[model samples]
Target: MNTTTVITHQPVAPAPVVVKITERDWSTSLCGCFDDMASCMYGMACAPCFACKVSSKAGENCCAPCCVPGAMIAIRMKVRTRLHIRGSLCSDCIIDSCCGPCSACQLSREIDNSCNGHLM
Candidate 1:
């Protein structure tokens, strides 16, 4: 009598699971300009310098925001995406272009509130 046996083998263990990187909601709102008085004053006093400082705190090129036309928009987008804010790049650009000081102030306030005035 002859018996036939089938052997089943499993392939290498399933590849390690890939985790999706998800960001969290923003700490503050885009239009919350008056939330921080000091930031507002700094931004209002000197838009370029204020923007540069905000950009620096956000881990970006310190001089880009002042030298580049759309740099403020980029910085806003970065913070938005990093903080998981729901907004469009076009809107950010418009805000950056139309109200440079306000945008910088808001962004500065956001970073400060989120990080407690510490680099993240």
Candidate 2:
């Protein structure tokens, strides 16, 4: 007597994983005050306003963007997580809270860089 065996394979393969990263490092550093004169001036003149504008340009609410407590930290975390930027929430909070103007300038630069330097 003889026996026959048959084998079958899946038609489609598994989907590929996609990862999105913002950039290797921040467009500007926390103390790089002269990196972006405009951004630095704006941040220094009005940190809240600058943060709000940055948030708006980055697809977030314009008003009260950084007015609320922990708002900057929250936004930073959100942006970092979405863009796959490596950082901790605690560090974000500390940085934003300690250096408001620097943080705002950095955030603005980051958003602009992420959006390819366009007014998105």
Candidate 3:
């Protein structure tokens, strides 16, 4: 006499999906501060206040920039990372160090545009 065995195959769970984020340029350029006169004036009139505002808008503590040294660069990095904007820490440093007010205004505009669905 001979005996035979049967085997059955079961389906396995599918692999996890990986989303590839395509880095893009900032919604507004660093020097595009003047494009939004309101923000530009606000930033120029009171840079610290503007920085704090942008910091808060970016989801960081409002006072972080005022209390922490080089916090703007960190804020820029955070915003850049959050928005998947293509930029480097060195460039952020240069922008913030050269014209802090302008950087703040740009960040503000970027945040505004992001919130307004202007960025894809």
Considering every candidate listed, which one attains the maximal TM-score? 3
Candidate 1, superposed: residue stretches over 4 Å from native: 1-26
Query: Would you estimate the TM-scores of all the predictions?
Result: 0.75, 0.72, 0.81
Kindly report which residue pairs in candidate 2 clash with one another.
Answer: none
Off by over 4 Å in 2: 1-23, 117-120
lDDT of 1 by residue, 1-120 (tens): 999988798568877989886766556555676577778788888888888899899888899976887888988898888777777999888887888888888788878877675346
How many backbone clashes does every candidate have? 0, 0, 0
Summarize candidate 2's per-residue lDDT along 19-88 as a digit string, tens digits: 8545456655778777679989988898878888777766677775645677777777776666666788
lDDT agreement with native, every candidate: 0.80, 0.74, 0.87
lDDT of 2: 0.74
TM-score of 1: 0.75
**Model 1: how far is 82 from its true place, Å?**
1.1
Report lDDT (Cα) of residue 93, candidate 2: 88
Instruction: Please rank every candidate by TM-score, starting with the best.
Output: 3, 1, 2
Put the candidates in lDDT order, highest first. Answer: 3, 1, 2
After superposition, the stretches of candidate 3 with alpha carbons farther than 4 Å from their true spots are 1-16, 117-120
Tens digit per residue, CA lDDT, model 3, 1-120: 999977687779999999999999988888896679988988999999988888888888889999999999998888888899998999999999999999988888988888662222
